[model samples]
Target: MDTSDILKKVRRIEIKTRGLTNHVFAGEYHSAFKGRGMSFSEVREYQFGDDVRAIDWNVTARFNHPFIKVFEEERELTVMLLVDVSESSSFGTQKQRKRDLITELCAVLAFSAINNNDKVGVVFFSDGLEKYIPPKKGKSHILFIIRELLSYKPKKKGTNITETLRFFNNAAKKRSIVFVLSDFLSDSYQDALNIAAKRHDVVGMHVYDPRDKELPAVGLIQVKDAETGLQQWIDTNDKQVRDYYNQQFSQHAQYCRNAFLKSGAELISIRTDEDYVKALQTFFLNRT
Candidate 1:
C-alpha cells in the first residue's frame, strides 16, 4: 500500500478501535486481566471491620493510634499479540477478509491495553518468526502496531504454530498476557502451547470463516490450498465428499479446543462475518 493509504487506514482503525476501548472494553479488560501482585500504598486509621492482621504496629506507635496497612494492585502489565500471517488468513468470503478482521481485533486489543496503562507488543508469524515489536507503553507505539498489522506481508506462506510458540517462549522472559490469533489450521503445536502456557497467560483467538466448516452443493469445483499451493477438484454435490470435508474441519477445530484445554489456556472462536465485540466481552467475563 502507498504511504497515504497506509496512514489513512491506520487513522481509521485508531478512531474506531480507540472509541471502543474507551467506552466498552476498558473496564472489562481491566477486570479480566489482573496485575502481577499487590504493592504497599499507605497506612490509614483502622476501621471497625479492618483486618486485625493488617495493623501496622510501627505506624500505630508513631501516631499513638491504631492504623492498618493498605495495599493496591500493581496495574502495570505486558500484553503480547501473537498474530498469524499465514496464507489461509487471506481467504474469506464474508464482510471482510480474515486478515482484516484480525487487524481490527488487534487494534482493539492494543488500544485497550494502552488504555489500561499496560505495555503492548506484537509477534507476527508465518511458519517462522516474521517480526517482533518489543513491548512499550504509549499511544504512538500502539498506533505503530496497528499500522503494521494493517499492512504486513509475510515472507512465508505456510503456518508452523510450534515455531511461533517457541519463539514467544524464548523472547518473553517475564510473564505476560499473550494472545495468539490464528485460524488454527496447522498442526503439532500442542506441546509448545502447553510449555508456553506454563510461563505465560496465553489465550488463543481462533479466527475462522463459516465456509471453511462446510461446502455448498455447487457440483464439481476446483480448489487450491493457500498454504501448500496445491490444487484439486472435488465434487461438492457428493454427500460423501461434503461429509468428509465437514468432518475434517470439525476435527481440526476439536484439536484446537483440546490443545487449549490440555494446556490450561483460554480459547475463543470469532467468525469473520460476526461481531467480535460480544465474543471478546464473553471471553473476558469468563476469565474474570
Candidate 2:
C-alpha cells in the first residue's frame, strides 16, 4: 500500500478503536489490569468506616486526633504488543484478513493504554525479530504504530515464537503488560513463554479464522502452507480428511491454551468474523 492508503487505513482504525476504548474498554481495562503497586497519597482525618489498620498513629498523636494514611494505585505502566507478522497472518476467509484484525486489535489496545496514561510499544516478529518500537506515550507515537501495523512487510515468512519471546525478555528493561497477538500456528515456545510470564505480565491474544477450524466439502482442492511453501492436493469431499483437519486444529488450539495456563497467563481467542469488542469485554470481565 501507498502512503495515502496507509494513512487512511490508520485513520479509520484510530476512529473505530479509539471510540471503543473511550466508551467500552476504558473502565474494563482499568479493572482488568492492576497498577504496579500502592503509593502514599496523603493523610486525612479518620472516617467512621476507614480501615483501622491504615490509622497513622504518629500523625494522630502529633495532631492530637485520629488520622489515617491514604494510598493510591500507581497507574502508570508500560504496554508491549508482541505481534507475529509471519505469512500465516495474511490468511483469512472472512470480512477481514487476520493481519487486519490484528492491526485493529493492537490499535484498540494501544489507545486504551494511552487513555490510562501508560506507555505503549510494539515488537514485530517473523521467525526472528523484525522491529522493536520503544515504549513511549503520545498520540503521534500510537499513530505511527498503527501505520506500521498496517503496512509492515516481514523479511521472513516462518515463525519462531520462542526466539521472539526471548528477544522481548532481553529488550524490555522494565516489567510490562505484554500482549502476544498471533494465530499461533507454530509451537515449542512453552519454556520461553513461561520465563517471560514470570518476569512480565503476559497475555495471549489468539487470532484465527473459521476456515482454520474446518474444511468445506468442496470436493478436491490444492492447499499451500504459507510459512513453509508446501503444497498438496486434498480430497475435501472425504469426511475422514475433513475430520482429521478439524482434529488437528483442535489439538493445536488445546496445546496453546494449556501452554498459557501453565505459564499463569491469560488467553483470549477471537475469530476473524466475530465481534472482537464483545470478546474482549467478556475476557476483561472474566479477569476481573
Candidate 3:
C-alpha cells in the first residue's frame, strides 16, 4: 500500500482501538495483567489496620511510635505479541481477512499496553521468525508497530508454532505477558508452549474463519492450500466429506485447547466476523 493509504489505515485503527483502550479496556487490562511484585515504597505511622509484620522496628525505636512499611504493586509490564504471518492468516470468508483481524487486535493490544505505561513489542513469524520489534514504550513506537503489522510482508508461507515459541522463550529474557495470535493450525508445539508458559504469562488468541470449522453443502468446490500452494477438488455435497472435514477441525481445536490447558495458559477463540471488543472485554473481566 502507498504511504497515504497506510497513514489512513493507521489513523482509522487508532481512532477505533485507542478509543476502546481509553474508555473500555484500560482499567480491565491493568487489573487482568499484574506486574512483577510488590515493591517497597515508604514507611508511615502505623494505623489500626496495619499488618503487625510490616512494623519498622528501627524507626519505631527512634520515634517511640509504631511505623509500618508500605509497599505498592510494581505496575509496569512488558507485553509481547507473537503473531503468525503465514499464508493461512490471509484467508477469511467473512467481512475481513484473518490477517486484518489480527492487525486490529494487535493495534488494540499495543495501545492498551501504552495506556498502562507498559512496554509493548511484537514478533512476527511464518514457519520461521520474520521480524522482532524490541519492547518499547510510547505512542510513536506503537504507531510504528501498527504500520508494520499492516504492510509488512513475510518471507515464508508456513506455520511453525513450536519454533516460534522457542524463539520467543529465548528472546524475551524477562517474564512478560505473551499473546500468541494465530489460527492454531500447526502441530507438535505442546512441549514448547509448556516451556514458555513456565516463564512467561502466556495467552493464546485463536483466530479462525467459520468456514474453517465446517464445510458448507455447496456441491462441488475447489480449494487451495495457502501455504503449500496445493490445489484440490472436493465434493462438499457429500455427507462423508463434510463429516470428515468437520471432524478434522474439531480434533485440531481439541488439541489446541488441551495444549493450552496443560500449559496453564489461557486461550481465547475469535472469528473474523465477530466483535473482538466483546471477546477481549469478556476475557479480561473473567481473568480479573
Candidate 4:
C-alpha cells in the first residue's frame, strides 16, 4: 500500500478502536491489569475511614492536627503487542483476513493502553522477530504502530514463537503487560512462555479462521501450508480424512490452552468471523 492508503487505514482503525477504548475497554482494561504499586500522593487531614497506619507523625506534629499520607496506585505501565506476521495470518475466508483482525485487535489494545497513561509497543514476528517498536506514549506513536501493522512485510514466512519470546525477554527491561496475538500455529514455545511469564504479565490472544478447524465437504481439494509452502491434495469426501484433520486442529488448540495454563498466563481465542469485540470484552471482564 502507498503512504496515502496507509494513512487512511490507520485513521480508520484509530477512529474505531479509540471509540471502543473510551466506551467499553477503558475501565475494563484498567481493572484487568493492575498497577505496579502504591505511591505517596500527598498529606491530608485524617478522615474517619482513613487507615491509622498512614498517619504522618511529622506532619501531624507541625500542624497539631492528625494527618495521613495519601497514596494512589502507580497506574503507568508498558504494554507489548507480540503479533504474528507469518504467512498463515494472511488467511481468512470470512469478513476479514486473520491479519486484518489482528491489526484491529492491536489497535484497540493500543488505544486502551494509551488512555490509561501506559506506554505501548509492538513486536512483529514470524520465524523470528521482524520488527520491534520501542514502548512510548502518545497518539502519534499509536498511529505509527497501526500503519506498521497494516503494511509490514515479514522477511520470513514461517512461525517461531520460541525465538520471538526469547527476544522479548531480553528486550523488555521492565515488567510489562504482553498480548501475544497469533493463531498458535507453531509449537515448542511453552518453555519460553513460562520464563517470560515469570517476569512480565503474559496473555495469549489466539486468532484463527474457521477453515483452520474444519474442512468443507467438497469431495477433493488442494491445500497449501502458508508457513512451509507445502502443497498437498486432500479428499474431504473421505470421513477419515476429515476426522483426522479435525483431530489435528483440536490437538493444536488443546496444546495452546495447556501451555498458557501451565505458564500461569491467560488465553483468549477469537475467530475471524466471530464477534471479536465481545470476545475481548469478556476476556477483560474475566481478568477483572
Score each candidate by Cα lDDT.
0.93, 0.94, 0.94, 0.94
Model 1 C-alpha lDDT per residue in residues 1-288, reported as the tens digit of each score: 988999999999999999888988879999999999999999999999999999999999999999999999999999999999999999899798889999999999988988889999999999899999999999999989988887888999999999999988988889999999999898789999999999999999999998888899999999999999999999999999999999999999999999999999999999998999999989888878
Candidate 1: lDDT of 259?
A: 97
Candidate 3: tens digits of C-alpha lDDT, residues 1-288:
999999999999999999999998979999999989999999999999879999999999999999999999999999999999999999989899999999999999999999999999999999989999999999999999999998989999999999999999888889999999999889889999999999999999999999988899999999999999999999999999999999998898999999999999999999998999999999999999
What TM-score does model 1 achieve against the real structure?
0.98
lDDT of 2 at 9: 87
- Give the TM-scores of the predictions, in the order they appear: 0.98, 0.98, 0.97, 0.97
Off by over 4 Å in 1: none
Candidate 4 lDDT over residue span 9-38, tens digit each: 898999899999999786999999999999
Candidate 2: residue 124 Cα off by (Å): 0.5
What lDDT tens digits, residue by residue, belong to model 2 across residues 115-200? 99999999999999999999999999999999999988999999889999999998888889999999998888999999999999
